[model samples]
Target: MKFLKVGRVAIITRGRYAGKKCELGEGLKTNSETEVLTEELQVVIIQPQDNGNKSHPYPHALVAGIERYPSQITRRMSKAKQTKRSKVKPFIKVINYNHLMPTRYTLELEGLKSVITAETFKEVSQREEAKKTIKKTLEERYTSGKNRWFFTPLRF
Candidate 1:
């Protein structure tokens, strides 16, 4: 099996986030400002849970991706509304390595490093707030025509 590095884009093939595309891991930023580095996080292999879940024996890597696809721009809506509707809804989840179908696309979202911290997933309110920031970042990237295919909803 291939190792999943940070910034690797993948599709979630199982559970609630099934079919949604996600990028693997947040960036690596050391506390020392003088020695700034944004490298891929380490991939650690952990022991399988005792739950006897055959489908996903040993899970590795945590990824964050859009939970809901952006809404279509309707002519009936105002410009402000249209702008709001364009944002991507995001979600952070610890998924099974097998459940993710890796793609050739890899999106290195610079804002995600600051927005998605370990504490972002600690509470509902914090998570929701972080999602809003992530939504804005994704929207900017999408509108800029960078990684257009990666941003679009996957078709059957």
Candidate 2:
């Protein structure tokens, strides 16, 4: 059974979020029917390539939805403006362990675990709120000048 700590950053290797980056947030039982429980875990996608869910083709949606850093945030910007300018679009998913390629980075944000979860994706309002949480945390992290590599877009 895999038992990885929450908050480890990883890249999705399959499915709609493939090639995108995310942070491990919760550990879930891979199965409960036959397994002893304690296998796979869930993640919070911080830098997604496209519509991580739904039937839409990943390539088509990825053209404009990819982002891994904080956009310019000026003091003059209003709350609504800031929210609109944010490029972060986080998704919470309880995916299989094999699909995630763990990285050396780990990012722990306040209220992240509470706001982001597999259920957060069930409703549009919840997803939007979670996105806002992710954006705020990321902006804070970026401005604080820590976890530089985690926030940088992958090259090549």
Candidate 3:
């Protein structure tokens, strides 16, 4: 099974939100009489706005209603396949793990406020700082051509 945890920040490497960032929301578990110990490992995520909005455009009700597995959230598909489904699919799309790049940052879950202490916040801050330093170094060393960046270039 893939290693995943709630609150981890990830970048959508494919789909409409390819360049956008997201955070793990919650995980789904399953229980059965046949195997009392076996569990289904699935996850749901929250795609935060790039502009850092106080409230996400997608309502909390919608987010809570959808049950997206990790496989659905991180799967990569070709442009042709994506176009085929675009017309009929729902506005909110699930991404795949292969398409998500987990960043060094993680958002604090409101439900876990009591569990996440000051020390956890310090660790998150340190990770954010490290990410900034890494980004700065990468920016200094790498230059992208007009159409060479990972995300598809938008045409006017």
TM-score each candidate: 0.68, 0.59, 0.30
Clash pairs of candidate 2? none
Q: Write the per-residue lDDT of candidate 3 for residues 30-90, one digit (tens) a residue.
A: 1111112221111124322222223322222101101111111113887656434322111
Q: Which ten residues in a row have the lowest lDDT in candidate 3?
A: 61-70
Candidate 2 lDDT for residue 28 = 29
Best by TM-score: 1
Q: Which candidate gets the maximum lDDT versus the true structure?
A: 1
lDDT of each: 0.59, 0.51, 0.31
Model 3 misplaced stretches (Cα beyond 4 Å) = 1-3, 28-93, 112-156
Better of 1 and 2 by lDDT: 1
Candidate 3 overall lDDT versus native: 0.31
Stretches off by above 4 angstroms in model 1 are 26-58, 74-78
lDDT at position 10, candidate 3 = 55
Error of 2 at 40 (Å): 21
lDDT of each residue in 83-104, candidate 2, tens digit only: 5655554445554555667666
Q: What is the lDDT for 108 in model 2?
A: 68
After superposing all C-alphas onto the true structure, candidate 2 shows an RMSD in angstroms of 10.9
